[model samples]
Target: MTRVPAYFDAFLTAVAGGAEIDHVHLGHWDAPGAIGPARARAGFAQAQDRLSAALIAWLDLARGHLVLDVGCGFGGSLRTIRTCHPGVEVIGLNLDPRQLAVGFRRDRRRRNATWIAADACRLPFAGGMFDRLLCVEAAFHFASRRDFFAEAHRVLARDGVLVLSDIVLTRPPLPEEEVALLADGLEAAFGPWPDKWASLDAIGRDAEAAGFTLLVTDATANTEPSFHTIAPGRSDRPTSGDVLRELHRLGCLHYLYLRLDKR
Candidate 1:
């Protein structure tokens, strides 16, 4: 078994305790009906709707297909996918044992879904094992994007699709102070962001380098509504009271939804 990174283990532990993996997103962001302490349920409803929209936009899921959910947290997305596409076979994979435990505990009776504790960089399946791969909110933990992409490509069947959503730095920080601030924020939230996050252009280049044909890349900023609904007390700016602000300031977020076809 590949040794899990200490930071990732810590992140899983934190999330299991109701802490958001990203420091900026509120603990209650994933709550079903309301953002923290907010009386408005519409925001929560909209948040769920927007997430469903984003997931569908990214996945293009089909029936009777084998789909892998990489970095699936608590199996919520896996359960949702199975519910949405009843004919699809969905498997959730996570490197964090604690997170997987949570998923399994919550979904042990769901026959259409399976949870696997596995490393993204070195998947345990045979080559061409899956028809589609989906990753949300976890690609940044990969130490080597090239290796991660290569592994995904190796396990994917020819012409299989890969859909991923993650945080990307739009512009390189200009000053040393800015860079340090970003690093510190990341460390506080999870551990360390990957050393080589590319610009949007670079993301495409790297996909090509890993032998994938890029199909789509979109942002969630416009699609996702304000955090006010999900995390009522959250501020737009980083302050002690605003978790979302801290996440944004730390450069911990900026959505990138990408689709690629394996060659």
Candidate 2:
């Protein structure tokens, strides 16, 4: 198995508990609605399923359409497609063999689901083959978002849609300040972030340059309060989830969803 990247490993543990979650949204900015721990867990679980369903709905998938989930984690969303959109073929692509190995077990007895070890920006598929390409809170890690956008445009069939959720700075950065709310987060966490955060405007420009027309864009302001409720924490130091929640609270980043159609 390929070695997992440190930041991704940190993300898996702190954000998704290394489980079969659909997506590890960086921040849960919503207020915990006066609920108990057990109820909170249930609520967050439901919210995850809802988000997955919403993305699928945005895909507007039809039977026999080919779907590619770039950066698929444990194949959760691919399995969701297999269950909900029968006859649609779904492929889960990830660079990490460790992830692909675990994800392989998730697609048992399912002819519609397949997993591949590959790079997101350098997709191995033929041009104009896929009806949909999905990225669930996973694009930031790509080496070059522009390259990925170009590749996405090349691989999608005519009028195919690209639906993705991502974290972005509200706008272009001005003079910046850095502050730490906690000493440490998770078992291990990403070191001081390198200047990789991109604004929504930047991503939109990249998509447009790649011949995509924007169909929908919205911030996930109603993100569930999963940090305090679903994931464990400590007072001495923050979990990786805490670091992200703090960043979101500080307005450094926001979760957003976008749908762009191949033009």
Winner by lDDT: 2
Runs in model 2 deviating more than 4 A are 1-4, 7-39, 170-195, 229-233
Tens-digit lDDT track of model 1 for 33-92: 333335334454445445544655566777778888887866766777777788899888
Deviating ranges (above 4 Å) for candidate 1: 1-49, 171-174, 223-253
Please, what is the whole-model Cα lDDT of each candidate in the order they appear?
Answer: 0.65, 0.70
What's the CA error at residue 124 for candidate 1, in Å? Answer: 0.4
For each candidate, give its TM-score against the true structure. Answer: 0.75, 0.81
